[model samples]
Target: MKKRLIVGISGASGAPIAVELLKALRDTGIESHLIISHGGACTIRQETSLSVEEVQALADKVYAQVDIGAGPASGTWESLGMAIVPCSMKTVAGIWSGYSDNLMLRAADVTLKERKKLVLVARETPMSPIHLRNLQELSMMGAVIMPPVISYYHHPQSPEDITRHLVGKILDQFQIDLPQFCRWEGEPHV
Candidate 1:
């Protein structure tokens, strides 16, 4: 099978990041297997002009989030890893506890079991103590808990630019490069 990356879209504020990530994956010729949770579908409608179907089109394959038997739910499916963009706290808790109630969570669980990369763009502000603890445990378990925190050093001019930069950073965890991703250079000599 071609190189594959599982992309999970959960309900969170940064839906645009997920959209851009899909577009980037398409541009790089990576086969993207997408799974959008019910909350994710709602977030797409609320946050972006594109419908969930439109976003799904960017991926090479789309799986229903409710389908727990989906290809990504099994370790045998084989993939570079899984990325949950705009991951909600609920989804994080689900994965941290191995509560594979849906395909997205199940895929994450499988990724951890297979010792594959599981990058979570956790999108929440002022994370509660519970959130921090869960995230800490997940990090200890080897999942990359990358919240969508902005980097001013990149000098992002617009929201899209920020989103792309964040997506690039997430892809970096998988060793995938986004051509437009700007790397930070140290201060210029006086």
Candidate 2:
């Protein structure tokens, strides 16, 4: 069966990561259920040529950020996992505090409560103690607190290359194998 993944895009600056993740999922024949926050919508327009509609069109299913009634908000809904690419610090805090004000937070909360994989591509830098504590809490709760740290081992040559590498790492946490990028080996390439 095709795996169902919940893709949440928050208002983080790295919108390209979310875009590439969605495209990778589509390319890999996985079903994506997406939720784009208002800030995410703005960042996409600011960062990419693709329109918000074009991005939403890539998903098998799309939910509004405020749609707490969405299937992803229910633990009973069978999904492989959820990934929040370019996860905002605000969203991370919300998840840490069990604040399900929006669908993204609610879905993440559900993913945690259901003991499913929750991958967060956190995007903040020079984080405060609060941020670190929130990440710690989420980590304790089984959420993968991944950041957008790219590896140079693959010899990335472009923005797309970098994005693919990071997305591949995110998918790795979910055990979704895709040929998005090459794994690192500590040997010099000839």
Candidate 3:
């Protein structure tokens, strides 16, 4: 059977990461179940030409952010793992505190409790003490708190290239490595 992954898009600055990840997931034939927050929806609108409905259309299934009773909100629902691409601090705090205020957080909470892979692509740059502490708390609890740090060695020529790298790293947390990303050898690719 095809692998299923839960994708949560928070209202973080890096909307491209989610877009590329979804595209990659589709290319790989990995079933994606998506949940997006209000902020995430706004970010998608602000950052991309794709409408919120268009983004949602990329996924095999989409869950309303407010639906805490969604299938993904329960641990019994099987999945390879879940990733919050461009994870916002609000989402981070919610997951860190086990504060399932919405479907995204609730699903992430369930992912952690079920010992499934839970990757958070935290997007804030100037992280405050609260952010750091929350990240630490989440990391300690076994979530992969990955920041969208770009690797310059690849010498990416375009935004899409960088997005591919970020998407690759995000998917890597779930052991889903796509060949579209550049892998650093002993030296940088020129």
lDDT of each: 0.93, 0.90, 0.90
lDDT of 3 by residue, 82-158 (tens): 99988999999999888888899999999999988899999897999999999998899999989988788888999
Q: What is the lDDT of residue 124 in candidate 1?
A: 85
Worst 10 residues of 3 by lDDT: 180-189
Estimated TM-score per prediction? 0.97, 0.95, 0.95
Error in Å for residue 93 of model 3: 0.5
Best by lDDT: 1
Candidate 1 clash pair list: none
Model 3 vs. true fold: TM: 0.95
Candidate number that wins on lDDT, 1 or 3: 1
Give the winner by lDDT: 2 or 3.
Answer: 2
Runs off by more than 4 Å, candidate 2: 188-190
Q: lDDT per residue, candidate 1, 98-186, as tens digits? A: 99988999999999999999999997888999899899999999999999998998888999989999989998998889997899778
